[model samples]
Target chain A: MSTALSQKLDAVSGNASGGHRVNPGELDLSHKVILYLDGISVSFDGFKALNDLSLTIDAGELRAIIGPNGAGKTTMMDVITGKTRPDSGTAFFGQSLDLTRMNEPEIAHAGIGRKFQKPTIFEQLTVFENLELAMKTDKRVWKSLFAQLASDERDRVADTLQRIRLVDEADRLAGLLSHGQKQWLEIGMLLMQEPRLLLLDEPVAGMTDEETERTAELFVSLAGKHSLVVVEHDMAFVEALGGKVTVLHEGAVLAEGDLATVQNDARVIEVYLGR
Target chain B: MRTPLSVRMFQSLPRTAWLALAIFAAIAWIAIPAAHLLLPESSPFHVSAYTVTLLGKILCYAVVAVAMDLIWGYAGILSLGHGVFFALGGYAFGMYLMRQIGTDGSYGVALPDFMVFLDWKALPWFWVGSDSFLWALIMVVAVPGLLAFVFGWFAFRSRIKGVYFSIITQALTYATMLLFFRNETGFGGNNGFTDFKRILGYDITSPQMRLVLFGLSAALLIAVLILGRYLVTSKFGRVLAAIRDAESRVRFIGYQPTQYKLAIWTLSAVLCALAGALYVPQVGIINPSEMSPANSIEIAVWVAVGGRGTLIGGVIGAFIVNLAKSFFTVSFPDYWLFFLGFLFIGVTLFLPDGVVGLWRKLRGKRAIEDTDTPTETPADAKGASA
Candidate 1:
């Protein structure tokens, strides 16, 4: 199992142009963890969704969390983002940032951005305006009253459009976008927020192969710049993402290794693959 | 008819054009007072004192309606007792006017005519120092502001919103009306404080005074509308709409909505009070009946009848409703209330957005169709299997 983890790392080391790439060295894992989670528990009506679980991600690391349905993956994301505060535990960001002490918006302002299972864009606003608004920029009364998008601000918007690859469709209404496009726009909004940490829930839940590939391209490009924690059920997409894959089962880390080792593990096969 | 051509031209024009038109209307309003001052005394288009006074009264109502819109249309707080605030301001101003009358009153006593008629020995405690115009102006702004603050603090803190908030506000106005109706309260009871002698030493019935009052009211109405626009277009206004659309979400967005709600509520009250201060001397009365809950509810009708979210619409609605009211009461006095009730029902049901909203729909340009789209982008199906 250790070899499996190191072997994936070794491949990325060997080929600068590695395929099915999982970079063990792109992120400085030796750096003190940015987000720390330990002994976190949440229950809904006596059912323990997140039991005594613990995890940590280094600053700028892209860690993908994979689990079957009912594995408490969504709840874990909820706990980190402050949507659902744990019944008990210490969830911290950086050295002294106690996430448990904050609320959702505070958490968002504290540099954690969450993309929910469903997109919640301001439907009334246009696509570009939605992204601009999400930047949470120009919060001043004067800026809003004057309402002239400055030249640099306009350039930043254009840059974000290019990064999201929605520059062509910047003028299109967000509602008019295709499902894949909407998902990309939502991701674009989160990206424009320029969060230090991003918790993306099921980002590839329903994507065409082309879109999925492009999203993989997008995430791969983003890995070194921002610490990404993606919770998804798609193993193939996960493999495409190529990171330290943590397989969560019944609210605990059942296995942590490359997919081949986890796939062949008897326990993981029974709990997740059902083989 | 050439109506369709004009309508098409209007529809095809940009939002800037619409804003330009509103600006022109305000300039024209200021022009009226200028004409009264400078134009020949008997020129046909030159405004008469009576006409100016009547228009001034309409302008005062427009200010009140704008205040109503600030709360109801923007904040989603429907205050059904706004008339209480307006009346409170009027009575405050009236107190000063009363004191100005002094020994010139019908009874020729130090106290108001009603007080001397009732055989009062001295001035009431609340009536002290009300003779100063400066003090009266302070009371005009403060009385309503403080009351709204107290009322809003309790009601909003309790988390009582929607129709319940509306009903409680109505009850507040009704109770105040009954309280002021009693003669022993020293507010002239049912007679409601009339026989004004002077406003800042100018003869109350002087035509020049009436014209000046008209200009003041018109200027104020224009100022409030401009202020309302500035406020509604700000980030604060976006948060207000967010509160209106989803309060919980606003909290999640890192803002405590109560402060925002209270600020706008107090602002609306102050505006209404200013309107009342302008309203009283022009109309020549400051009666307790002004506090009637029905009048407050009618303010809501004005906001709805014009266009709730649009501030200028509220002013237009107030002007149209009252003009219709004047025309209707004179022509068919028996059915005025019936006409108003049905008018409100028809607007709410059919228009939903109000007349300005309907007009925007017709115009099509700058129409913000808020709810016609679905969200939650579905990830590509192939990506899911991948």
Candidate 2:
């Protein structure tokens, strides 16, 4: 079983060939697009949460998604992370791995990490243990039971503590950390996996001005090494990231361009100011 | 240089925990047995057979409480059907005990007296190898483990949780109890399996046999406590606790929540079965009543009252509740159920952390005082304040 799983991981890590066929773990990013969603629609009982949404994210690009409430900002992230299945669409990681065919953990294992809107760290565990859990290790039950942190893994956790500015609070329970600290810890957890792409929902929703600026710096630093798709209501935070922006209205992309251009778009203004 | 075995064992647990376990082992293995067997009946120091049996019974219950804690307390899967697993284990062992009766039964036939009474001609197909003590041991673990695996696989795969999960487990045990009560199901109807003559060829009621069983029960409890401690402290245990706290977060971190729940659920069932296997020989009876939904709910109360997450708390809870049960059932038999209900309510409201949590809070306060220099108040003190 372990061998079979390792073989599958190997397939995922190997170079992906150009193909239209759906492969479980293959990702061909030679075309530069890391995530491709075309003609996607999702509904709840007759209400359309996402309607005919199409978006593409380029490799190593940090893209921010902005929209009014119920604009399907959260829904789009849900569809990408396999939290919610679209009724009809083709969603792919790179060009081959089908996102629709995968589950949440499988999507994550395929190297897409998601940070929820709320800061969701394991409150009972120490800050170090929380990061340790998110580290890219074998997640099988028996393997985890006997697993001891290698020196390098320990060093990585320590490094994350310093990076998140929680070095002094490393041993403290995560629940005891202040709200901003918990958000940083969650972001730090996502970073530990060294994910190929990250989907963060409201990354700076509840941070002070200084913390928000630091977070903006952190995301900027992470941009080229990892592709990031950030969804936020904070227009200033999005401007700080300085990325190409997509605005969604009623589950469809209404505007797409640089942040300044999208902000001034007629539909974007109508949805924001008109409401 | 390689570490010595003694050092390694010590490192696995704290020095104080080891000392406590050693003391318990000495009492169970040497002192208790000596008092029961060596001391004269007239002597005040004599430990009666009744006391030994009762303690053994409570030890089995303690093991069950610990197993329940593993799933409910740590994994956040409150299984109200744990009694099903416990009773299945008891019935498995009880089958072998029944077969051991052989010609000694009331009917003096190859079949158990129940079969003769029912006018049945042959043993049921399910009882084929049940006469073998080894097979009984295997079934004691396997039956409950398999049931839990299958049940958890389906329920967890579908993502059933919280009170809904609890309701389904209660229903499962309720259904099993009803099935066992039917005579055609071949579990001896409501009377279940009883009237044991021997186990491994020794008279079941002999002092030597009873003492042996009592000693084994104590040893198993300690072993389970140690095993439970090791597991909860491991990374796997950390993940289980994480699932309890935030299951969706666990999934987002690339863990299949179902798989973790199923693994722990199956393990917890196996532990309950082992406890049940020990229980039958000392209690000398196994009945469908053992699988009643109320009994399983009581198992949760024991863990909750003792402190859910603490491994030692489960053991302590089992002993405390059952000891009270023995006294109340005898002294004030009619009010015992009401008393139990009140105790559960009291623990839920006033002692949410159980006895262990209470102890920790007190110790935390004392430690703060001993420091003499006050810095920031501890997190536990904050909890106490709240």
Candidate 3:
């Protein structure tokens, strides 16, 4: 299983591979907004999880959502991806498509991919098949009957494998991989779909320190090219993601700023850290 | 324990294996009939009286087994109304057989012996043209297919799932059983249709005709098993498997599961009906008893006992269970029910996937757990830099 030419990044600059160190002042955010959530509220059995929560993510922006347990972070991901329809709200994708009206599969087809707290790569398939199957959706009886990956598809798959750093293990069954490898494989699966927006829930929750550091590096590289909304509780991982942070308390945004600015905010401390 | 023979066979030259299956089927088709014709009646290769009847019944069961595996093993649908589908097919074919017996019936008149015995004036509107084998064959396929479509449409659209769905299917079969039991239904009132004269003008009593039907059944069984195996390996097969593990996840990946579920479900029912159509003639009777709730439940136990999700395992399961059934009923009539119950419990507890599943679990689990590797998360700096 050789690496594909397209997704392979050039050699690491001394220390970091695929790590593109960015200067904050160079960010150009005047582009069109890709995702807009307005006046959305959801309740489960009389418990309000999202109360009039509205937020926007411009194309290529990586937004971090940090909150305590049950602050509606996961629920928010569900609403956007169409897993759970909000009771009332307006969620738009690319300034037009009414997301609230669409179902999960429709939203997925419309280009929003989500990775759950636990990685869910197909365990029975090989790593290469995991990515290849993710890219294929022509599930007709005959089409599936004669499925064979094209040459460019082969190249793209090889490229994705190298990008995920699993090119050497392409033929290996995914279930045989480590927990962190499983997580990466699932992320790779989501990438194969080429989603415009990604909703990742606790992507680094259960990983070794090294795996966590590597994941932080991966998210940093993924942010601008694809608008990403990452929900995590790890402060160090958050520091690695250096950008505007939205601190959630109960079901609404308590504070939004740079990591240092939000950490020092009295209200943020009162609800989150609680001196 | 290394790599299962079937998986290795499928992996090495898949097209060649398919060719082999086709060639084997062709040989069986010609050789069995030819052996019965050319070889002496006492020859070992010649089809025997006992073997002919047994093979016909086994063929019918094979069709039903394939249908069950399609829904339960592939589409993640566990149906308990398959017996009803089979009976509907039998009744369709039975009507033709009853018509064939016309004027030669017990009372010796133009009425079915049951209608004559029950003192009916004329044929029921539904029974009209059942005298034609062509019409009966069409009904045999159509009735079960239509019922399945309507049932699956409502069940799938509403998104009923899990054990709840299985219970509902059981209830449907139970209801149909009650409907067909009444004396007023004109379906022979418990003592179902028998004493057939002919089918399509061929003497039903002939040993040669019996041998032909048996050969057809054996060949059909082998063919359906091959088709089932092919289906579960394809991309659509992956979708169905994904649906089984996580429906919401698969739906998020852009597959409307209802359509796929319903399509496979209806196909399973139709196959069961075809099996039933073939079954009634060889078994020498067609009755409402075939639609019993208990019978359908038994089929599930058969599949579970064989191992689930592996297509061919269901066939082995059916043959073993039913073969044991015939022996137990004759040898130890009082212990048959208890023996089956114990077998079901044992399989569920120790071999949840069936025999093949148990074997796969032991072998595949070791292979998967023995190796470990590092995670492959991309360590790029693009997102961190922002």
lDDT of each prediction vs. the true structure?
Answer: 0.76, 0.86, 0.75
lDDT of 3 by residue, B22-105 (tens): 775665577766776688988878876666677578668867877798789766788877899988888888889888886887
Error (Å) of candidate 3 at residue A151 is 2.6
- Model 2's CAPRI class is acceptable
What is the lDDT for B348 in model 1? 91
* Candidate with better DockQ, 1 vs 2: 2
* Winner by DockQ between candidate 3 and candidate 2: 2
Interface RMSD per candidate (angstroms): 9.1, 7.0, 7.8
Residue-wise C-alpha lDDT for candidate 1, range B1-386, written one tens digit per residue? 11232332343234674686577566545677677767887887787766677778888998999999988888889999999999998999989988888799877778888988888999989888798899999999999999999989888877789999999999999999999999999898988988887988889888677777877887787678667765664446655765676565344334456777888898999999999998998888888889988899899999989988788788879988998998899899999999999999999999877878888899885555322111112111222332
From the highest DockQ down, the ranking of the candidates is 2, 3, 1
Going through the candidates in order, what fraction of the true interface contacts does each contain? 0.20, 0.68, 0.45
> Rank order by TM-score, top first?
2, 3, 1
Candidate 2 chain A — worst ten consecutive residues by lDDT sum? A13-22
Candidate 3 regions exceeding 4 Å error are: A1-31, A136-146, B1-47, B109-111, B116-120, B357-386
Q: Is candidate 2 or candidate 3 better by lDDT?
A: 2
Give the residue spans of candidate 2 off by over 4 A.
Answer: A1-24, B1-12, B365-386
What does candidate 3's lDDT look like per residue over A140-208, in tens digits?
444554554445666778888987789888978877898888888878888887777888888887888
Model 1: runs farther than 4 Å from truth? Answer: A1-31, A43-50, A66-78, A136-148, A168-178, A204-207, A245-275, B1-51, B71-81, B112-129, B146-192, B235-263, B287-292, B364-366, B369-386
* lDDT score, candidate 2: 0.86
Prediction 3 TM-score vs. true:
0.85
TM-score of each candidate?
0.77, 0.93, 0.85
